[model samples]
Target: MQATSRNFKDNAHRALEDANLQKAMGFVRTGFIDKRKAAADALPEFEALRDAARDIKNHTLANLDRYLERYEAKATETGAQVHWCTTAEDARETILEICRSVGARTATKGKSMIAEEIGLNDFLERNGITPIETDLGEYIIQLRKEPPSHIIAPAVHVTQDQVEADFRSHHKALPADRSLAEPQQLVAEAREMLRQKYLDADVGITGANFLVAETGTSVIVTNEGNGDLTQILPKIHIVIASIEKVIPTLEDLGVILRVLARSATGQEMSAYTTLSTGPKRPDDPDGPEQYHVVILDNGRSAMLGTEYQEMLRCIRCGACMNHCPVYHAVGGHAYGWVYVGPMGAVLTPSLIGVDQAGHLPNASTFCGRCESVCPMRIPLPKMMRHWREREFERHLNPPAWRWGLKAWAFLARRPRLYQALTGLQVRLMGLAGRRRGRFASLPLAGGWTEHRDFPAPQGRTFQQLWAERKRAA
Candidate 1:
C-alpha cells in the first residue's frame, strides 16, 4: 500500500533491534527453507516436474482467452456465477453487487492476494459490512492493524509474544491472566473465537490456488481447514481469483501442485487441497446456497504480450524471497508492496507504475538462487533486468548510477583508457593493502567496508599479464 519499497538499511535496522521480530524471522528462516529442501530431495522427478509445470503455465497464458471462456461456460453450466472484471474498479463493483444482492452483513475471508490487490475488505467495511480474516497469519496482522508483510506468510514477522498480546488486546472474552505461551494455545483461542463467526457470517470469500477448467472446479490449498469452513458453512460463497489461475486439466494442476508444495513450505502436500464447484446441490447435506467466482484481470492480461509474460507462471511459492541474499538481510516490509522479493521487483513496477516502483528492481543482487529454486522456473533475473531497463529508459535511475554507467561506457569504448584506469585501480589497491593487508575504511567504498572489508584487487591487470606472457613466448 505504500507504493514504494523502503530503504533496506532502515528496515533491517528496525528488524534487528526488535527482539520479538528477530525471533519470528529466525523461525521463518530455519523452518520453511529446511522443509522445502527435504521435500525436494524426496521427489525424484522434481526437475522434470518443474519443466512440465513451466510448459503448462506458458501454454495456458498463450491460449488464455480460450481457457477463460471455456471455464466460464462450464462453471455457469454447473450453477456457479462467473464474473469477469477487467480492472480494479470493475472488480470492486461486481463484488459490491454480490454483497448487496445477498444483503450480506458479516463476511469471513480466507487469505487472498487478489482480494488484497482489489482492496475488497476496505470496500466491504466502508459499505457497512464487517469482514474478518480467518487465516492465522492474516488474523494476527489484521488484529495489529497492519498490512501483510509477506505474500505467503502474512505475519512471518510477528513472534509468539506479539500474537499473545494481539489476542489479549482484541478478544475481550479471553481470560485476564491467561498465559498464552505456545502456538497451540493461540490457535485454540482463535479457533474458539471464530467458530461462532463462521456459522453466523452471511458470506465467505476465498482465493483460488488453481482453477481446473476441465471440471470447472476452483482448487485451494491450505494448511488449516479454515478455508473449508469459510466456504461451506456460509450461505454465500465468493471466490475472488485472477483469470490466470485457470489450468486446462486436473493433470496440469497436479504437475503444478507437486512443485507448489515443495517450493512453498517444502511439504509433500498441504494439509488440505479442496476443490469446489458452484453451490451445494439439493441432494448435498450442507453447503452454500450461492456460489460466485469473480475472475479479475487487473492488468495481468496486459503482461501477456510483454517481456514479463513469464512472471505470470508464478504459483506464489515464495521460494525466491527465501533464498534471496537481500531479502534475507532486509525482510519483506522493505519491498513495501503486496508482493515482495525477486518476483515483486518485476511485478510491482507492472502493477503499480514503473516509476513508482522502479527502485524495487534495483534492490536485487542479481543472484541466481531465486530462479534456481523457483517452482515455476520463471526467468526472474531477466525480468528484473527488464524493469531496470525500463527505469533507465525513463530516466528514473539515480544520477550516481547513471553517471557511473556513462563513465564506464565511455572508457569501455576506448580499450587503452580502460586498461590504464584498471592499472591505476590495481596499483592503488596494492599500495593500500601493503600496510595491514586490508583497509578498514575506503574513500568512496566506505559503505562497502562498513560491515565488510573489501578484498584487495590483484596487483596486475589481466591485459598486462597477457601482454607480458605473449612477449615472453
Candidate 2:
C-alpha cells in the first residue's frame, strides 16, 4: 500500500514496455466502452438520471452533517455502532479495535477502496490478524501481494495466464493436472479455496457504495455476491466507507444506482445490490450478530467549498479511465496509487498531496472524453488543470516547466509579439521539416517525439491564415 507516485514516470515507462499489461489494457476499451454505450442508449432517461444523481450528491454534501447525524441516530436505533474517523490512522486503529473486541483471528473482506486507502490489509496482518479477500479480483491481487490497479477490476492489470499461475502456486493441495485454461475454471478454484475462509472468518468487513440517511442502511452493489457473503456470514459485520458516501434518502440512492452499474460495467443493474441496516433481529434467521460503520474522512472534507468539490459527485463508475488514452497506454500501476485514471489523477492529489502526485494531473492530454462519459458529470480534465495550477502555484513543478510556462505567458500577454515570434518560428520549422513534414526528434520536446514524430507546421500559423481569409472576404 506504499505509494510510488513519485516514480510515476519510471512506472509508466515500464508499463509501456510490458506486453502483458498492454494486452490486458485492451479490455478497458472494448469491454467497458461498448457496453456502457449500449446500456445508456437503451435507457432514454440516462442523461437525466446522471443529472439527478449529481444533484442528490450535491444536496447531501451541502448538508452532510445533518444527513450523517440522522444516519447515525437511525443506525444506532437498530443497534449498529457508528464511528467517525477524521484521519486514516483513526480509521485503521478503529478497525483493529473492532477486530480485537471480537477476538477475530481472521476477517473476510469485500473489495473496498477505503481499505486500500488506509492500508488496512497490511495493518491487520501486522497485528496478527489474517485478512481474507473474497472478491475474485481482490483475492487474485491479494495472492500476488499487489495493490489494485483498477478500482472495480483490481486484477484488470493481471492476465488470465498470470491468474492461473497464481492459483496453481497458491492452491498446492489441488491437483497439479487440474485445467485452469478457462476463466470459469479459475473462478471455481478460487471459490472452493475461499469458501473455507468465509466459514471460519470471525468478522466480515465491507465498503458501502452509499450510506442512506433515511433508513440508516449501508448499500453494496456487486456482480459476484461475494460482498453479501463477506458481510453476512461472519459473527460481526464492519462497514468501512468515506464520509462523502452518505446520501439523504433511499429514493436518492435509487437514482444513483440506476446509473452506477451501467456506467461501470454496462449492466442495467448489478446482479446483487445488498442493503444491511444493522445486526439481525430476533426473528431473522441468517445475519451477523453485530454491525459497525466506520466513516473515514481522509482529506475528503477539505475538498468542500473549493473548485474540487465537483469531484465528490463521482460514483467511482470508472468511465473516465475506460476512455482515457493515457491510462490505456500506461495502465493503472503508473498512477502508483489506489485510485487510477482520470478520477485517480484528481482525487489522489487531494487524498495524498499534490507534492507527491503532481505528475498525475500533468499526465492527461486534455481530451475531455472523461468528462463526457462520467456518470456524475465530473469535469475531470478541468480538475486536473486545477491541480496543475496548484502545483505551479506551490512551486512544485520542475524548474524547466516553470520557466517554460513563464516564457509562454510573457509572449501570450502581447498579441502582436506572440504572433510575430510564432510566425518566425513556424517559417523556420516549416523550411526545416518541409521535406519530411515531421520531426522524429526535437530539442526540448524529446518527451513528445520519443515515441512518435511531431508534425511540423504547414507554412503559416492560424492567425496568419485567419488574416488572409479576412482580407479575401
Candidate 3:
C-alpha cells in the first residue's frame, strides 16, 4: 500500500533471517518452477501462444483510445456503468461512492492487485464499510492483516502451520480443537466462515484478468471458485482494472488464456474461468442487479509511448517472479509493494517514482531468467537497466555509487588505463588468495564477501586472454 521500497535492503535482510519465511519460500523453490516447466514443455504451441498474446497486447495498447471507447459503449448498452479514473484517489473515491449508493455495510472482494495498489481495503474500513476477502489466499492474508506476498498465491509466504494458527486465532466461534493439519481442513474452515459473509455482502468487487472490448465482458480465472460466489451473490458487482487489461476480441482472449494458466500454475485451465458481460437479464436465474466497471490509469498512460511500454503486456501470470532467483531468496514482501520480483522491479518504479523505488531495479542479477520465461516476451532485464540509467541521471543514487561509476567511466574511456589497473589489481588479489582460491573478505566488496567468499582471480583479465588468442591465430 505504502512505498517502503526505499527500505528494501533492510526488508530483504530480515526476510533472509526469518525461519518461517524461509520454510514458506521452499514451496516457491519447488512448486511453481517444476510445474510451469512441465506444463510449458507439454504444450508444443506454448511459445507461439506467448508471441500471439504479446502481439494482441501491443496492438490493443497502440489503439487503446479506440478500443476503450468501444468497450464503454458496449458495456453501457448492457446497462453497466463504466467509470474512468485517472488516479488512485479517484478510483478509491469512485468505488466508495458506489458502495455508499448501495448502502453497503460489508463488501465481498475477489483478489485484485489494483485494489491493493490503491489501498482499497483500508480506505473502505476508514469509511465505515467492511471488506471481506473471499479468495482462500486473500482470506488468509486478510486475517493476518498483511499484504499479499505473491500475486496469484497471496498466502504462499505463509506456511500451513501458520494458517492453522491464524484460523484458530480469528475464527473463535469455530471449534478450537478442530484439526487443521491438512490444507483441505483449512479450506473447509475458511469456506464455512466466508459462506455467510457472501450472502450478507451488499457489494461484490473483483479484478478483471482480461477486459474484452468486443463483448464488454470482465473475466476472472480462479481455482477456488470463490470469485464466482463473490460476484454473483451480491446485489451489486463492481469490476476494478487498469487500462492495459483491455483486449480487442474473444479470440485474442482465447490466445492469452491458453498460456495464462500454464505459465501461472501449470494448469491447462483454472477450475473456473468466469466471464460477466453485464447484470442479470429478466430471464436469468441468479446474478447481480447492478454492474459497474472502474478503469484506473494510475500513471500507466504515461508509459504508453516509452520503451517501458513492453511492461504493460504483463498478464500477471507471474512466470518471471516464479523463476526469479532474487525473489526465491528474500520473498515478495522484501519488494515492499503490491507487485514483486522482476515485473515489480520494472513496474513499481514506473507507477511510483524512480527516486522512491530505485533500489528495486538494481536488485536483479542480470541473469536474464525473467525475460527468458516471460509469457509476453517483456524485456525485463533491459527495462531494469533503463531504470538504473534514469536513477543515475537523476542523481537518485547515493554519492558513493555516483563517484564509483564516475571513477569507472574515467578509466573505461582509456582502454590502456582500464586494462593496466585491472591487471595489476587482479594479480595482487590472485597472489593474496592463492592459498584458498577465494577471499573471505575484500575491500569495497563487503556486501558480497560478508555473505560468501569472493572467488579469487584465476589468471589474466579477459583483454589479455583475447590478445594472446588473436596473436596465436
Candidate 4:
C-alpha cells in the first residue's frame, strides 16, 4: 500500500526476472481475454449495454452530490450509520474508532480495494486489531504478507506450487501430507481455517461495488460467497467505499451489474451478488447488529469537472488491465500501488501525486485494447496522454527526456529535413542489417534490443511510400 510507483522501472525489471511470476501471469493471458470475448459475443445487446452503463455513470457523476446526500439520508433512515471521510487518514481513523467502540479484537474482511488504498489492515494491526482477509485470493496474499497483484484476482501473480508452499507454511495445524495439489483442496483447506475466524470476529469490513441511492444498499459481487459470511456473521458490518460508487437507483445498478460480471469474470452474473440494505431487523434470523458505511472521498471530489472526471466511471471490472499488454508482461506489483493495469495508470496519478506516480501513465503501449474492452468505455489512452502532457508541462520528466522531445520537435517542424534525415538513416540501417534482417544490438535502443532483436527498416519511410504511390496513381 506504500507508493513504490517511483521505482516502477526497477519493479518491472524484477518482475520480468521472476520466473514464478511469469508463469503465473500466463493465467491472466489465457484466463480472462477469451472468456470476456465469448461472453460479449453471446449477448446480442452487450454493446448497447456498455453505452447505457457509461451514460448511467456519467449521469450519476454529474449529480453525484445529490445522489450522495440521498444515499446518506436513506441509509441513516434504514438504521445504518453513514460516515463521510474527506481523506484516507480520516477514513482509516473513522473505521478504527468504530472498531474500538465495539471493543473489537479482530475483524473479518472481504476484498476491498478502498481498504488496501488506505492501508487498513496494517493500521488495524498496529492499533491492536487483527484484520482477517476471507476472500480466497485475498487470504492467499494476506498469508504471504504481500500486496495484491490483481484487483479482482489478487493472487494472480502467485503460481499453484507457490500457493501450496504458502499454505503449508501458514496452516501449520493442518496435516503436512494434506493434498493441496488441487485448487479445490486448497479452497477447502482455507474454508476450514476461516470458518472459525468468522464466528470469532467482532467486526466485518467490506467494500461496496455499488451503493444504491434509492435503497441505501451496498452491493458486492463475488464468485465465492466469502463476502457474505465476512459481512453477515460478525456482530457489526462496515462498508468502506469511495464516494463515486453511489448510483441513482436499483434499475441503474441492474444495468451496471449486467456489464460488470461479463466484463470482469465473463459470467452473466457472479455466483453471489449480495446486497445489504442495513443492519438486522428483529425478524431477521442472521445479520449484523450494527451496520456502518464509511464513504471516503480521498482525491475523487477534486477530479470532478476536470479532464480526469471520466475516470470516476470505472466499475473496477478490471477489463482494461486484462487486455493491456504492459500489464500482461509485468503484472500488477510492477505498478507499485493498489490499483494496476490501464485503469491504475490513469487513476494512481490522480489520487497520489502525479510526481510520485508519473511513470504509471507512461507504462502503456497505447494499444487501445483497454478502451475497446472497457464496459464503461473510459478513454484510458486519452487520459494517460493527458497525464504525460501534465508531467512534461510540470518539468517532472528527466532533462534527457525533455531534450529528446525538444530535439524531435525541432526536426519535426521542418518536414523536408526530417524526411531526409530519416530516409538516409533508414537506408543505412537497412543496409547494415540486411545480413540478418534485424539488429541484435542498437546504439541508443539498448532497452528494445536487450530482450529481443529489433526488426530493420525494410525500405523508405511511410511518407515516401505514400508519395510514390500517389505519383504512380
Candidate No. with top TM-score: 4
All candidates in order of lDDT, best leading: 4, 3, 2, 1
lDDT (10s digit) by residue, model 2, range 1-473 = 68889899999989988999999998886898999999999999999999999899888889988999999999999889999999989999999999999799999999999999999999999999999999999999999999999999999999999999999999999999989999999999888999989989999999999899999999999999999999889999999999889998888988999999999999999999988898999899989999999989899989999999989988888889998999999989999999999999999999899999999999999999999999999989999999999999999988988999999999999999999999999999999999999999999898788878999998899999999999999
Tell me how far the alpha carbon of residue 118 in candidate 4 is from the true structure, in angstroms, after superposition. 0.1
Candidate 1: segments with Cα more than 4 A from true spot: 6-20, 434-440, 446-452, 458-473
Alpha-carbon error at 265 in model 2, in Å?
1.0
Q: Write candidate 1's Cα lDDT for 254-338 as tens digits.
A: 8899999889999889999999997999999999999999999888988989999898999998998888877766677777778
What is candidate 3's lDDT per residue for 1-473, written digit by digit as tens?
89899999999989988999999999898899899989999999999999999999989999999999988889998888999999999999999999999789999999999999999999999999999999999999999999999999998899899999999998899877878899898888888999999999999999999889999998999998889999999999999999999999999989999999998999989999998998999899999999999999999999999989999999999889999999999999999999999999999999998988999999999999989888899999999999999999999999999999999999999999999999998888888889999999988999877767999996678788899999999
Best by lDDT: 4
Residue-level lDDT tens digits of model 4 in 1-473: 69999999999999989999999989899889999999999999999999999999999999999999999999999999999999989999999999999899999999999999999999999999999999999999999999998899999999999889999998898779878889889889999999999999999999999999999999998888889999999989999999999999999998999999999989999899998998999899999999999999999999999999999999999999999989999999999999999999999999998999999999988999999999999999999999999999999999998999999999999999999999999889988988899999999899878878999997688888999999999
The TM-score between candidate 3 and the true structure equals 0.97
Give all candidates' CA lDDT scores: 0.86, 0.93, 0.94, 0.95
Model 4 stretches astray by more than 4 angstroms:
470-473
The positional error of residue 384 in candidate 4, measured at the CA in angstroms, is 0.6
